[model samples]
Structure formats: C-alpha cells, structure tokens
Target: MEKEGLQRSVEFFKHHNINIKTLVTDRHVQIKKWVRENMEDTTHAFDVWHVAKGMKKKLFALSKEKDCSDVSPWIKSMVNHMYWTAASSANLNEDLILAKWQSISNHIINIHDGHSTLFPSCQHDDLEGRERHKKWLKPGSKVYEKLQDIVNSRQMKKDIPMLSSGQQTSELEGFHSVVNHFAPKMIGFSFHGMLSR
Candidate 1:
C-alpha cells in the first residue's frame, strides 16, 4: 500500500511536469528498490528518525543481554548522536557523516579522538570529572564489542550516508495523526469512504 501511494504520487507529479530531485522516506526495502530502478534520477534518502527508532529498538534489546547491560544507560545519548549526525553533517559528504556516526564507539569508551581521518576528533569541551565516575566500557569487553558491531553494522554503514539532511517526515506524521483520528486504522472504510473521511 505504501508503494502504491508512492507510485501514485510519482505519477501525479510527472503528470504535472514536476521533476523530483530528492525523495525522503522510511527505510522500506521494497520502496528503496523501486526508487532505485524507476526513479534513477532522484536521490532517495531514508528518514533519520525512522532509522534512529530502529536503532534504539536494537539497543533496547541489547541492553537486556547479559554483559550488555552497560548500554542501557547510553541509549538516549546514542540516538541523539544519530540525529545530530544527520542534521549537522555538512555538504553531502558520506565519509564525513559516517566518520561522525562511528565516532560514538570511541565516545562511549571515553576515548574521543582518532576516530577517523575525516572527523579526527570529537568536538567537545574537555570533560572535567564525568569520565571518572561512569563505568566506561573496556575495549575488549563484551559490551564494547557488541556496541562496535552495532555502530559499524553493514546496514548502518550504508544507511548513515543516505539519511535525509533536510526536511523531516514529522509534519507528514502529524498530518497522518489527524487523518487517523478521523479514520482509525482498526476500522476499514471503502475507497470512496476513505477519501470522504
């Protein structure tokens, strides 16, 4: 149904002679492939919020795994880092964006330097006493290993570069909320009925 909506939207835009230069949507695999094949001229980007939501779910699950409980305390900060990376990344430089995203692994261990040549060092005031109190992950420990895997996962490496840098779907989601208030998903309506609603 989502793909159908995208197809209809594209057709409508094409009918009106408006070329879409960039498109942003959640990381829907089918839609991604469709855009790749059908809208080759368009730059399709994944919504950062959606990607971050998915990442948080994984982090939450990992937080429960034995030897991974240390991650529980940092989930919110990590997600915020993703949002910051997506929004603050300059130009469309994928490498720089990725370098920033991957820097968190070091940051978690309180080693905020030498992440990548592109980013080099974390941009932060020197921590006065914070590092001394927290239980930072040891490099070879299970939690750190799992965190490194999560941060450098193949999917993250690919999607990190493709995150939408401008214009989020939050407004669209707000519109959907209004629509759902009128036409709740649990109750089905006919095509014309849905339109009227």
Candidate 2:
C-alpha cells in the first residue's frame, strides 16, 4: 500500500480505538507523515537495526570523500549508542550527545538528525516506559519465561558439548538468515514491500 492507503488504515485503527501503543517501522516519509497526522498519541519508533544499517551505508559512501574507515567503527558504535539513548529517553542531553557525535562529518550528521526527527517527541522520563513494557509482553509473561529457559538450555549445551570450536552465534546468525529471506532483491524497493504485508 501507498501513503494514502497507510493513512486510511491508521484512520480505521484510530476510529476503532485499536490499542496500538507503538508503531515500529523503517524510515519512510509516508509512514512518518501518516503517523504524525493521525497517531499523535501512539509511540513511533524506527527499528534500531535498520538505523544502524543506514549509518553504515552512509559511512561507506563517505569513505570515498574522506578516508572514514579509520573512524567508521567508532562512528557506528556511537550511532548504536544514540539508538539506545533515543530508545531510552527523549531528553535534550541524549539528543545533544547524539548531535555532538554526528558532528564528525557535518553532512553525514545532518542526515542522522533528519532520521531522528521522524520519530515522535520523547520525554525525559521515557526510560520508565521500557520497564512498563515488560508487563505487556506478547503471548503473556510465560512465553518470555520459556524463552529464558531455552537460552539457559543452549548455554548448558555449549558447556557440555563433546566438541566445540567456536561460540554460538545463534541470534546474529538467525538475524542474517531472516534478513536474507525477507529483504528486497535490490536496494530502494518501496517501504511497503520491504515491511508491510
């Protein structure tokens, strides 16, 4: 669906009073616009992993102009830090820290700022919200508990395995597998195709 269709869907959800606490999406202008216009109360968050990937892409692009490879890792680490900070709270201090880090390359930093602006306003005490999220986890708390159990089981396997050379990289490995399965065949595909059903 296009922007208009997304807007319509959001309107319908709003009309029906859907309990959409947060809308997670990539940085798409249409989705950003629709969320701004219709879902003022809903929390809007761009996916952290996507933001990091974008930063990495831009860093690679900038490497031609200025040898950014030396500082690229630092910049990426800082970018990830910014995501955690922004995800935690909307305080000006965190924003300022992010701004300062991006100021390495003014142009690149500006792009980062543009990405940050797409999200809804965050509050200083937003970290409290993360704690509250635990109470509302999907499939109930039991599911999360079971997940923890499975993780513990995997750790046990690692310790007791008859032969082991490398550490388990299940989460990261699984992430790449899923990305390969679902990401577009080429770059610049429509956001709807990339994300929506």
Candidate 3:
C-alpha cells in the first residue's frame, strides 16, 4: 500500500509539474528506504510525535529496571519536552536540538543554570515554584542513567533536526477517520458510494 501510494503520488506530482523537495512522514523504515532510493532529490523527515512515541516506549521499558521506578514518572514530561524542543528549534539543526534536549536533563536536576551550551540557564521563569512541588533525580542514579541513555540514543541523535519541525500526520489521521464515516470500512460500497467518498 505504501509503495502504491508513493507511486501514485509521484505520478500525480509529475503530471501536475509539482517539484517536491522534501517529504515529512512517520518513522516507517520501509518508507524511509523507499523515499531515499526513489526520491533522491527529496529530503525525508520523520514526524516528531512518532519519534517521541518510540522514545517513550523505550523509556517506559527502561523504567522497569531495578530501582529505576523514578524514571517512569518522568516519561510523559520527557515526551512533552521532546515536542517542545522540536517546535522551538525549527530554524536550528540537529546539534542545537540535542543541546536543547539535554538542557531538560539539567532542568530536571534543578541545575538549570550553567548546564546548557545553548542557554545560560533554564528558560522557564517559574523554576522556584516548580521546584517546590517536584522531586529531582539525583545525579548518577539508575533512573538518571536510563534517561540519559534514551536522550543520547543514536536514533534520537540522527532524527533530532527532522523532528524539530511541525510537520505531522495527525491531521491526516483525522481525515481518514472522517472518511471512514463516509465509507464505513465494515461494508462494501457501490460506484455511487465510492464516488461520494
């Protein structure tokens, strides 16, 4: 299905003289390779949410580690942090994205200042208030190590810049859901039904 979709899309674009320079999509390994092999002129980017979800799964697994339950509580916040880092670093490259992500580690540790290469201190102004309600991970703890492993993963490092943009398939998914209402998947449709869809 992906191959057919790509083929039709390529044909449609060629027929309409649309010169696509880049395409952003979820992290499907097959599609990634296909795009690279077939669309050499186009740059491929993985959607940030997909990447963050993947990271979340990995982190969740790591949180089950012995004495590392502390990492589990931070998973959601870390995923949100990934999204924020991506959205805020659109004009920047992978290095800046990684640096910004690393800053979150500093933020979690209450060492908001003098920790990030990109920022002199934590960007949040309500640090004191947040600190009052939160328990920070101690340095060299098992949970901290697991969190570091995720942030520094090779896949995360490679895809930071791609994820740093707003492109996503969320709206596409919504559209598909609406289409399903028009053309219910459990039943077959006639020519009119197909045409209406």
Candidate 4:
C-alpha cells in the first residue's frame, strides 16, 4: 500500500512536470527504506514533529527508570529543542545538525555555550538577560544521559536533515480534520452521502 502510494505520487508529479527536490514525511519504516532505495533523485526528510514524538515516547519510557524519573517532566522542553535544533540549522548539512542537537546537553545545563565540531564555542548569543525560569540539569546525571541517548539515536540522526524549516504537517493535519468533519470515517457513505461530503 505504501509503495503504491509513492509510485502513484511519483507518476502524478512526473505527468504534471513537477520536479520534486525533497520529500518530507513521518518516519514510517517501510516508506523510509523504500524511498531511500527507489527515489535517489529526491532528498527524503522526516517530519520534525514525528521525530520529536518518537523521542517523547522514548523519554517517557526512560522516565520510569530508577535514576531517570526526572526526565518525564522535561519531555515537552526536549521536544521543543528538537524543533529549535532543526530551525537553527536551516540550509546547513547533517554534521551541523548533529552538532547543534548534541549541544542540547549543554543548553539544558544553563550552559548555552558549547563546543561542537563545526563551532569551537557556542554560536548563539548569551541568554543571561532573557533566560528566566531556567532549569539546569547536570551533564552526567542519569536523566540527562537518557535524554542524550534519545536525541543521539541512529534514527534521529538519519532524519535530521529533512526536518522541515518552512513546511509543516500541522496544517495538513488540520485540513484532514476539516475533511473528516465533512466525510467522517465512522459512517458508511451512500451515493448522496458521498456527494454531500
């Protein structure tokens, strides 16, 4: 089913003379692998929200750990950091993306300054004045380690580049909700029901 949808989309674009430079989607296992093997001409990026969602699930699970109980509360902030990491590294390569992402361990410690491979020190300005309500976590703490593990995982690394800087599926999801209002999934549609929709 996923392959058929992809093939149909490719055919539709080709028929309409639309040159697809990139394809952004949630990290569906089959689709991700299929696109990598088949769509060499197009860059595949995973949706930032989906990547964050995956991280949230991991963090939630980790929060149950004996030393990692504190991680549960910080899940929301960590998800926001995922978006921040993606947005800040716009027009940059995967290495920069990884560097910025890895720097979060420093950022959470109220150490906005960092040492990444691409940048010797933190690139952003000092957050001294604006950074109120700061929640600092030690780098070597179990919660921090769990958070880092989730952020630095192999799947997150692979999907970092395609994290959307401009386009987002939030609006698309909203549109689907509206469509469902018109053509709800629960009811079986007759000819007139379909037309009404």
Task: Give the candidate number with the greatest lDDT.
Answer: 1
Q: Write the per-residue lDDT of candidate 2 for residues 151-191, one digit (tens) a residue.
A: 23432232111111122224554786778677745666587
Count clashing residue pairs per candidate: 0, 0, 0, 1
Model 1 C-alpha lDDT per residue in residues 71-177, reported as the tens digit of each score: 88788889889988988974658888999999999988889888888999988777667445666778899988988899999999999999988878889999999
TM-score of candidate 3 relative to the true fold: 0.83
Worst 10 residues of 3 by lDDT: 124-133
Tell me the alpha-carbon RMSD of every candidate. 1.8, 20.2, 2.7, 2.7
Between candidates 1 and 3, which one is better according to lDDT? 1
Off by over 4 Å in 1: 128-134
> lDDT per residue, candidate 4, 21-86, as tens digits?
888777788988888888889877777888888777888889898887766657787787779877
Off by over 4 Å in 2: 2-16, 90-197
Candidate 3: C-alpha lDDT: 0.78
Instruction: List the global CA lDDT of all models.
Output: 0.90, 0.45, 0.78, 0.76
Put down candidate 3 lDDT per residue, 77-171, tens digits, no spaces: 88888888877876686677788877877777768788656665667766556445677888898788778777877877777767736677788
Backbone clash pairs for candidate 4 read: 45-162
Question: What is the Cα root-mean-square deviation between model 1 and the actual structure?
Answer: 1.8
Query: CA shift at 31, candidate 2, in angstroms?
Result: 1.1
**Candidate 2 TM-score versus the reference:** 0.41
